[model samples]
Target chain A: MLQSIVHVCLAGLSQGMFIWLVASGLTLIFGVLGVLNFAHGSFYMLGAYFCFMVLRALGENFWWGLLLGPVCVAAVGYLVERFFLRRVYGLELPYQLLLTFAFVLLFDDLVKIFWGAASIGTPPAPGLADSIMILGRRFPSYNLFVIAVGPLLALGLWGLLEKTWAGRIIRASSSDREMASALGVKVPTLFTAVFVFGTWLGALGGGLAVPYLGLLTPGMGEQIIIEAFVVAVIGGLGSLKGAFLGALVIGLLSAFGTRFLPTFDMFLTFILMAGVLLWRPQGFFGEAR
Target chain B: MSKKGMNRRQFVKAGLMTAAAAALGPAVLKPTSLWAAESKVKGPIKLGYQTVLSGTLAGYGEFHKMGAIMAMEEINTAGGIAGNKLEIEFRDSTLKAPDAIQNARYFVDSWGADFLAGIDSSGQALALAPVMAELDRVLMVTHAATEKLTEEQVFKNGVKQIFRIVTPTYQDGNAAAFVAKDLPVKTWATINPKYEYGFTCWNMFKETLSALKKDVTFTAESWAPFGTTDFRSHINTIMDAKPEGLYSVEWAGELITMVKQGIQAGLFNQVKHVMFPVGAAMDVLEGLGAEMPDNIWISGRYYFLYPNDKSNNDWVERFHKRWQHYPAYVSEGAYSTMYAFKKAVEAAGSKETKAVVGALEGMTLDSPAGKRVFRKEDHQAMYDVPWGLTVSNPKYPFKIMGKQVMVPAKDCFARPPFEGPGTKPPFKA
Candidate 1:
């Protein structure tokens, strides 16, 4: 009984962490910027494709791909905020969604044009390709790498937001944009920077996923984005803490659901999201309006 | 009065002209060549082709386009069928049955398509069956492999307008079982696509294998939904089942991910025998490259290297030269389907739907996949596709088959009137 429990948890934890990596950027963007960027998923896809390209250019050097792939996404995010998203800051939610959705279609086609329709997957990280026996179940070390990275990123983000002056200004703008503007916060530029940072986080998740999933596809972003949205919703849409815990819960629920009730596995995540919203309408961490 | 009705003299003159032309035209137009022989056949035969073009499976559509367009150009360059120029319009089916039906309607009613080809999803193909009957246009299904399209929709329902260029579940399941019965395996498990194609293939294999060997047992099953990126959980399920053999029906990009993940989970080390119904597909082999583990039995609707005949070899060379890549089975099926249309039109001596359907039944054509006979009963093309063990070849970048075993189509295909339960077998085990 214990062995099965541990195995399920391991699977859930790894899956959840991967999702957290994507959801972190989403939660951060929505929290500070109040922009529900639908293209966040596209950013994740670009990260995987760029990383795969870099790996190929460097003869499959995975670390180089990991470090450089998300950096490229940061550059893309910068272009998006400076030119496109900058125009939509004062608009309503639907306008922002429509604008970001355009990027989703654009980026999906761009990836296809540049890389072709077939998938190109990265090799497992150096020395992390081995499997460890976990309670009589063989679990991949690459999965463990992903699991470890998720919490580390969460800690890094927590420190960056809570421990720095830039973080304070960003928080001030997020809470009261006019007051921060009056106090010389340069809110527009700050918003751009935050958006870029969030994009980088989403891309980092994509980079991590290349090895974990063992393949990069054009619309993989669309799939992961749906999962991230569920995580963000359950964790409270704009709450980082909520996203972190929510990812874990969603991941574990999906894993256990597949193991125990295979037929209902598809609905388990959505069902959890609905139940959580009914009980704590603001999610676990979102402030009550 | 003259504008509204034909005058007596005008009607008499038209009748005399028609009779004179009919008497003299046959003697003047001598068809020494097949195209010249059928002077009555029309010009500019229009074909509408549709397949998935926007999703992760978009690569399949690209391959379909390559083969169909290549054949169109070739037929046109050689003076076309029965003196008619071949023209083709390509559309994206987008993995939806409704979209496929809409495209079929537009192809026939709007684009004036005389014939159609290229459907990648079995759901889309099965959905288009009744629509084809309604439109009264012949649809040559290239990639979809559901047996129900042939058995239930075509054979049982008498949807004569639908014909498939690719082999159906008979090859994937029954032929696969014929190969497995000799492998000394008693128990099996499967991870299949969670759709009609998956369920049908598994059931077909189980029924045939059980009938062939009474002692064989199926231990467990996992059905992965379409577009499933993560397959580790499914892999674990198969591992726990611990069957003597594993059979996976995953294909294309999904299969690539499954194999890579399965290798990481040490699936190859645990299972002594494994089989992939569509593992020999070009994209999977090319995507995995050196990562693909050897000795797993694999087969597809068509293998580019099989048949090893002069005609097939020559065509593969031309195809590689043109596209700079080897042909996938869809491309082969699509390419052959265009030629099949040409043959039918020439045989029937017209581009009419009823004539073409009649011409296609029991017709044989030499293709890159060898001789394909459009069976008279169901219109499903019957041909030999061999099951081979994966092995690395120095000449090719990916793994090629090492040893291949072929069960003759006569031995494996379900017999006539192909009903679900009552269908007879071509030969007793």
Candidate 2:
């Protein structure tokens, strides 16, 4: 019984990391730009498809995809912001949403046109596919990797944001955007850079997720985007720290709900989000700004 | 004169020209006019098919439409029923029930379709059910497998014209039950989408298990909303429960996602037996590839590997050659339903709605999955439901079933009282 609890926790932590990867970017982009990129999950989906295509073209070496896929996705994100998003800069939220939603449809069908309607899934890395001993039972090694990497990435991002000039500028802008702009921060260029950076994080999440989740399909973007919204809202929109904390709470709640109330398991994530909203309208770690 | 008089004047001018052609010869004139008359079969027999061409279940809709088209072509080539050529028209409702009902009305009343059929979801069927009666049209239901369509919620007025060829949802649930009971598992956890069909299957399976074994317990269960992409949490929960058995009623892409995530999370390793009600689909197995582990029992409405008869094999080959994709269960059901419709039309000796319905009610037809006969009681087809375990074979690129069982319709179905009050059930009995 005790063994099963540990297993569940490990699996939940692994999943929480993946959620954090995508949701943190969501939080960062929203926090800085005051624009919710509805196509963020579309970017994530693109990352998976890009990785899959690159792997097949360049041979099935997971390492190459892990390094290069996000870079390529980041480049695309940069182009997407420079060309298309720039047009919608001063527009209403609905206009931004509509444009991003259109992109979602476009990218989804594009995946279908390229990969067909069937799912594209790859096996886990051979060595990490098997389970390692945990709590006297075996749990997947890949899950352990995910659990370990999530906090490391969070800490790394925190360090970069706090310690570096670029990080200080971003932090300053998060507090006082007008002041940061007046201080020669090149706010427009910074917004574009931040957009690319956040999209890269999302893409990296998608690329790394292929081996763990297995299949990436057309409508997956739509599903992920909704969940990302839920996570971002629950964690306090525009707060990276909030997203990180929210992902953990939602992930654990989902896992625990599944364990205890398997039938209502799917609703747990949303239920937790609802509970958090009722408690804190500004989100746990988010400020009014 | 009315607007109709202008069109009549134009026709008379053309006729005057044909009269001039009579000067050439009586033979040439008669032959030309007869050829013209024969060449055009008056407007063709319009059949309406409603499907989900652009949603989560689009794959199912696409394949079913392909099968329906194939059948329509074959019927048209064979000089369609009672010397009337077949014309099919399709509308996409995006798989939503209200949209489907609206489309159903449009096809029958506005589009002037003489016959109606085709739907991908049971919810759509329910929405269209009452309207079918109000419209008083014959709808040959093809792909959707909800038992309620033919049972509690059947079209009240158009019951006679509404004929279902596909087996009910419970047929699938019953097959899962039989397979699960045969296995060595004691405790089970079910993961199904939260909807009628999903609930029905889960309930039927639990009921069957309870009836079969007194001590079986369900340790955990999960009902994810339809179109849910993530299964990580559900996987963790199932692992925590550590049940010996797992049954998932999820189909198509959702099932594919669940299998991949479940395998990665090591949930399958924790359980001794897993029963995926619709996971035996070829597309899903091929997509999963190495992720599709061994000893997982799965069930589908049809298995292309079954029947192995020369004719069925030839059909399979021809279908593959044409589509380059393996036939899914829904596709097979569509094909077989068309064949059943053909057989029923022949038996009735007329395309009159009631006659066709009568002929189909208590008739049997051969299909790729052996012979299926519609039970006179509920209009549900009595055929062998295919169930088996996923066995990876080098002979095929995808996972194929081994230890396959053919649970007859008798085992997988129950007698129908259908609706509480019915003037005449869709079934003849």
Please provide, for model 1 over B236-332, each residue's C-alpha lDDT reduced to its tens digit, 9 standing for 90 to 100. 7777778889998899989999998889777888887999989999988888998999999999989999899898889999999999989999999
TM-score of 2: 0.85
Candidate 1's displacement at residue A197, Å, is 0.8
Best by DockQ: 1
Cα distance off (Å), candidate 2, residue B44: 2.8
Per residue, candidate 2 scores C-alpha lDDT tens digits across A222-273 of 6666766777888789877878887887777767776667666677777777
What docking grade applies to model 1?
acceptable
> Which regions of candidate 1 fall more than 4 Å away from where they truly are?
A1-3, B1-39, B420-426
* Each candidate's DockQ: 0.44, 0.33
| Winner by TM-score | 1
